[model samples]
Target: MSKTILITGASRGFGKLWADAFLQRGDKVIATARNLKDLQDLSDKYGQALLPLQLDVNDRAAVFAAVQKAQQHTGRIDVLINNAGYGLFGAVEETTEQEARAQMETNFFGLLWASQAVLPIMRAQGGGHIIQVSSILGLVTLPVLGLYNASKFAVEGLSETLATEVKQFGIHVTMIEPNGFTTDWAGASAASTTPMEEYAGLRKAFSDSATPDSFGNPAATTPAILKLVDSAQPPLRLLLGKVALPFAKSVYEARLAEWDQWQEVAHAAHG
Candidate 1:
């Protein structure tokens, strides 16, 4: 059976890739982008299967309005993919107030607004799925991506809480924690703070660690997404690329070891 899927940031990257995939498989996709023009090709190809709308996810009111319009179009949305965030690259101290706030606004608050907007509709329908496009940085840290890491970490916390809260309503929440993919995420879509001389070595080390295999092909993720949305039991979190799992495992193992080493000190604080 075909489902009605609403996706944000449908102009390009994973948003566009998944939208095209869903439409190809006969699902009704309500695609939202900041510039509606970016979706014209999809609209031309898919006809009624694609409903393109202009949206800036940072605008809370507009997000709610867009959700309402999408619900009216399909009567009930079976799934929502919140993929409307960008990367903010910088060292923690180098980040400006405006940049940090903007990162949270779109990446955290934007997802919050969209989640809130769809709740009433999904509740009325008795079920739905919400997929948040988080990153591997959400689980672990990387140098020179402090703001982006913080934003994704916020997404993880919010979405985890949301999953527990909405389980009773039969609304499933999943965070897609993708590692570096061959998308424009690190390219034109990324915003960077002015480089500080102190962080140059750190940046160089980070850049030097990259191998061609570190990034996955975005197109290859289609099947995983399709299966996730169609599943009777979807995971609370899904890692997209090959690198994510190993990276997460290493990070978490180290975290556990450190926590255990500090357990006595941590426990003493409670007294």
Candidate 2:
């Protein structure tokens, strides 16, 4: 059966790829972005299968309204893919409170709001799925991307807790940890706050290393995403790309080791 999937940030990158993939597979997609024009071409191409809408996930009221509208279009959303996020690259000290908060607003709170809005509809329908497009940085922190890393880390925790909480309601949550993809994630279109002058050297190095031109093609991960969407029992976490998989594994192993190393002392104190 064809499913109704609502995807945020559908204007570009993995979001656009996911929307196209789902449409190709005969799924009904309610594609949304801050600027609907970016999705206009897609809407023209896919017709009814792709319902394009303007959505700024950061706005709580807008998110609620959008989800309500989406539910009206499909009666129920079979899947909600929270793909709207931005990358903030800078050292912790270089990033301003406002900049960090803005990142959290879009990447963390935006996702939270969207999920909250959709949960009621899904619960009423008895089951649904939520896919969060997190990053490998969500699992591991790297230099110069502290703010981005923080957002993803928060998403990782939120998704994990949500998975457990929604299971009884027959709703599923999956977090996709993707590595570098050939998207405008680091080109002229990428989002970057003004870096502090003190860290100019580090920021320049990061910019050179993390540009979108250097990443692998985004098409590589679309298939995996479509597969996860269609699967009867998708895992709580889907690590995309070869690079992301190993990095995620390393993070998990290191976390486990650290926990194990502290377990004895932790338990002794409690006892």
How does residue 98 of candidate 2 score in lDDT? Answer: 93
Q: Model 1, 25-108: lDDT tens per residue?
A: 999999999999999999999999899999999999999999999999889999999999999888998999999999999999
Q: Which candidate is the best by lDDT?
A: 1
Candidate 2 lDDT score relative to the true structure: 0.88
lDDT of 2 by residue, 108-222 (tens): 9999999999999999999999999898888887888888999999999999999999999999999988888778776644566676788888767766676544366788877
List the candidates' TM-scores in order: 0.99, 0.91
Q: Rate the local accuracy (lDDT) of all candidates.
A: 0.95, 0.88
Index of the highest-TM-score prediction: 1
* RMSD each, Å: 0.7, 2.3
- Candidate 1: regions farther than 4 A off: none
| Backbone steric clashes in candidate 1, count | 0
**Weakest 10 consecutive residues of candidate 1 by summed lDDT:** 87-96
